[model samples]
Target: MKTNSEKTIFEMSVPGRKGFRCAPSDVPAADLPEGLARGALPLPELSELDVVRHYTRLSRLNYSVDGGFYPLGSCTMKYNPKACEKAAAMTGLSALHPLQPIETVQGALLILHETQTILCELGGMAAGSLTPAAGAQAEFCGVKMIAAYLRDQGQTQRKVMLIPDSAHGTNPASSVMCGFACKPVKTNARGNVDLEDLARYCGDELAGIMITNPNTLGLFDENILDVTRMVHEAGGLVYGDGANMNALLGIVKPAALGIDVMHYNLHKTFSTPHGGGGPGAGAVCCVEKLADYLPGPVAAVIEEMTDEEPPVYGLVEPKKSIGMVRAFWGHFAIILRAYVYCMMVGKNGMREIGETATLNANYLMAALKDVYPLPYDRVCMHEFVLDAKWKDAPGIRAFDVAKRMMDYGLHPPTYYFPLIVHEALMIEPTETESKDVLDAFINVMRSIAEEAKTNPELLTNAPVETPFGRLDEVKAAKDLKVAV
Candidate 1:
């Protein structure tokens, strides 16, 4: 079942074929440094059409939001608008150099400033920094800012960071990177922070608590205000993990909920392209108490004139900042896309996004909850976890069901996550998917569940229609290979 397009470009390279033509050198040829050019170039020699066909075929193999449904849980795989892409790709912003003079790149700075302003308003914070490149980086920066603020206030003994058991894996890692000891807080049967556990963990050594609203299980902790109050009583700040901000946009503000700091995933909440390891921007915001400790070079209004002239926008460092977390600010193009997205979806539209996202998730969860057992049977925010232990079989598992999904021309929901549910299949059907698509996915899932009971082998040996059949994933990971 091997295809011609699967062959490496080098495998199809002819001896004397050339894909492109180059004019004779107009200027004098300069020699490369010694030892730089040693042997014949190891490059593919193919015709123009061959090269084009090879890449075109490769692109077809990728499953993206544009291709079909990608309901990756806790990731917010929503569709980004073409208008946002066009705004990001505009020559005036895209073509500007990073090192250009501030006066010349005022427009880009203005976009950054306005974006930060809107983010602060949404999060109910006094200030924000848009320099962290991704969600994880933003978490790291936020934790570091907390550490810096604590140190400045002579609270060196406050070194413990409390993270909920259902929080994302990055929360603890980020806290530890900032020299804080991580303490795991338990989740109750209602899928909320065990208030007793939180009270037990709160002490003089407690630095802060990192909690995700609409947490990984897609349930918002109803006791969030109480949790933050407990932490604050022990002289600790509350850090909100805004990875699930899509569920709270224009609905709830983290600062108003007693969260001292939080990071917004522009990719997840604002419809920027994500997955395949990034090109993302995380907008970090904080209350006035911690604003001075934010990462430096945040976009700000540098000058203002009375009567007629407008305010001059520029980059300025925080008074007692944690220095730069990244080089040359962050992913500017991604930030621009997020800014355009916010503008396109104004205040009312933002509320609609939150409502629709939650509604879609609940709808999908309701349709599939019968075939798959729901861990927390109540209403969900933007996603929910299901136990893939329905069939009374031994070998069939969540991974098997996920691989089988590829056969139906759909990407699988996140499997075995939050570490709380056994054989967890975390599902998040974003607002972008239509009812027809949701019904189709639901029917396919129901059919697969039926097949699991009737013919378990079909689930075990799945993805028969893909480029290749089931593979020994462990062998592939343990033993690596390049040549084919």
Candidate 2:
């Protein structure tokens, strides 16, 4: 097989090729307006075979969770079950239009309502809204709810949102978007939030704190309860970023740990399709105090349940809702997939998901800690970060190691992220991966570490075995190209 194939559809076009012929019109041809007609339309002309083969080859070039081991840390890029996909594709569910009356789409409304109920029960929150498009939007919704609650209590002066230095980049962005000033909280030696520093900021001006439990460092903050207590005592709310919810699935609930409001990444925690900007759902849940301020059109049971018939489910706005954050019901298909995922996993399997994920992460961490320097040497929750800088291979960096992983036919773990670590190579072997696959990944990392010292040039000019060699990533970013 050829290593590289860069032919675009336009490039493969023939002068007068036709993939399909138009059927004869049943009615007479109508004339267009004076300015409506165009002399020519610029489109690729190719045979049906050529089009099919070209797209098929392109699809093969793309990497996915199904393709191989994707240990992208922070992002739980686990294998999505085919059963979820099948449920999402069901004609009874998929065929419904959003504009249909509530009575007509009762099944979908019930699924949405149940999904919200399940998420609330899992996160230990009172109520939730599954309207936010993705995690970031959900974070925004949570922040907005906090702002609304504060404003309602005549605490408009409380405008500061304390974010951890090791938080996802979206945390501060969400806070700012909600008209709150952001303050950075420091991380202690043990990777938990610095209580002393947090105490200093816990004043009337404090609106809340946005914390990621089992944070970006992939370690659960030991001082989480204290962090929340101080903020609450100071009359501020605590917003939990549940991006790493895979770790705490059934083991711990965010609300129990004093989180006033939080968002759950259905795409991450519930094994829905992730990536490609998405069709993602972020179900934002809150304590009873903030529930009324949630994003509108949350699924609810309109009519009470009876002995003979199921309860009537419908979309209802929270009493003091921040208003709709997304168009019509949000990503219904993604929500349906998540609903199916929860049903498939069940209660026992849900707990197992968390346990297995933590186990897999620790297993990988233990195997590679000697070869790669473990930054915060501790038990990681669901993912762990490692420093790629070695004394013997001083010149080799995390970027090189990441690129080199491609040569072994393995997708590289996230590198140069969470910003706190100097040369971070974060890895998360989600619960879906097997022991043999984890061992294979470990062997590849060991081989890469050895290659870094014995054959430094191999790491420098990495991915030589792949179809494309290492690229000028900076140039590719700055000099955008869209055409063939």
Candidate 3:
């Protein structure tokens, strides 16, 4: 049974329908160039009302942070404030072009400059560049800076980047892209980096370590400082993956914890629009030693503040800079949204974001641990991982539970990830959710556990209530059907 929303817009096209019809032209129409003219195009022809209703119905089929609970771990799919959206859409900011004169766009330049400063201050770094387009790009920029710094210091032998088993997959990829060989560091029983394993890899060939605190497993490394010290003592710079910055916010600074450089995912931590192949921003910050190698041009104040005149804000390329990693001055609209988020949250609220996110994750972890097996059973930072392999129902898996979640109208937590844990169901109930929502989610999870034991087939043939039922995922992946 196909739903009304399932029909493609093209399928609804009528022969002579028109959503809009231009009035007869007052001026003479100019003829197009020989190659520019086209015959009839295959666009859908529909009335204005038909188009609006079609899109509205189709939108209801999609899930969003605003629609319901999104417990996607490490991704931080939290509800962003609408006020930030309004700020980003403001005419003065949104209407300005990147090619506009610097003097004419002082307000935007000031915001960009202040945002860079704020990110550096928050991460405890001396300088930063808001030129990287996204978190992955920012990570690339950071690792490249480390490589440049090592080469400049004549330590070209530092070719190894030690990465923990629980680190985000991007860590090793970014290191390799920067020409550094990656070595996997083991995780201890307590979910922290294995100091013994890490120490063995620390040598003259060590480039650095790319660590994600409150790592992908949703646990903070207990021996983080020690780990960084070991690498630093071995003459290796530490590259912190700031994807988990939501868990630290105002609570701790990455640089103070021995991170030489890091990237801030504005989309994840700062509540900018996330996940939909974004116009995202990543602000990369570094200690004074590596500041010169940051990607340029970063926002900066060309002139000092004075009594009579305001300071002049401009873009500056750092000496020995890695050069432009992106077009223009990063994603301005996304950066503007982040700035608004920071200003609105304030200092105390920033701390609250970190604390409440931890509390929420712990709440869910404590509630679900009795049913789902928690691999590293301890207090989690801002997320927790669960092994969704129920011994009572061997047929049920994390993927089944995830699909079943859609039946309850809640988006599933990330499943089978961070690879270290078997059948991992990583959940991060961000600080934005209320207790009522959390309680409802907990109840739903408990019910799912019961169903897994009593009716294993229900778990296997999951998402019966959704628009689409459980699919043959492997076959779907192997032979995709993107369009109808």
Model 3: worst 10 consecutive residues (lDDT sum):
1-10
Residue-level lDDT of model 2, residues 346-389, one tens digit each, is: 87788999899999999999999989998799999999999999
Give candidate 1 misplaced runs (Cα > 4 Å): 1-3, 23-34, 474-484
Question: Per-prediction TM-score, please?
Answer: 0.96, 0.96, 0.96
Please state the error at residue 414 of candidate 2 in Å.
Answer: 1.5
Question: For model 1, which pairs clash?
Answer: none
Compute the lDDT of residue 377 as modeled in candidate 1. 89
The TM-score between candidate 1 and the true structure equals 0.96
Cα lDDT of model 1 overall?
0.91
Tens-digit lDDT string for candidate 1 (238-336): 999999999999999999899999999999999999998998899899999999989978998889756887778888899999989878868999999
- Give the clash count for each candidate: 0, 0, 0
Clashing pairs in 3: none
Question: How far in Å is the alpha carbon of 19 misplaced in model 2?
Answer: 1.9
- Stretch of 10 with least lDDT, candidate 2: 1-10
Candidate 2 regions exceeding 4 Å error are 1-6, 23-32, 482-484
Can you write out model 3's per-residue Cα lDDT over 1-484, one digit (the tens) per residue?
A: 6554677778777889999989899998888888886877878888998899987877887889989999999889989999999998899888999899899988999999889888988999999999899999999999999999999999999999999988788888899999999999999999999999999988999989999997888888889999999999999999999999999999899999999999999999999878767988989999999999999998888998899999999888999998899988989999999999999999788999999999999999999999998999999999999999987898989999999899899999988889899899999999999999999999999999999999888888888998679778898889987543
Question: How much is the lDDT of residue 293 in candidate 1?
Answer: 89
Name the lDDT value of residue 453 in candidate 1: 86
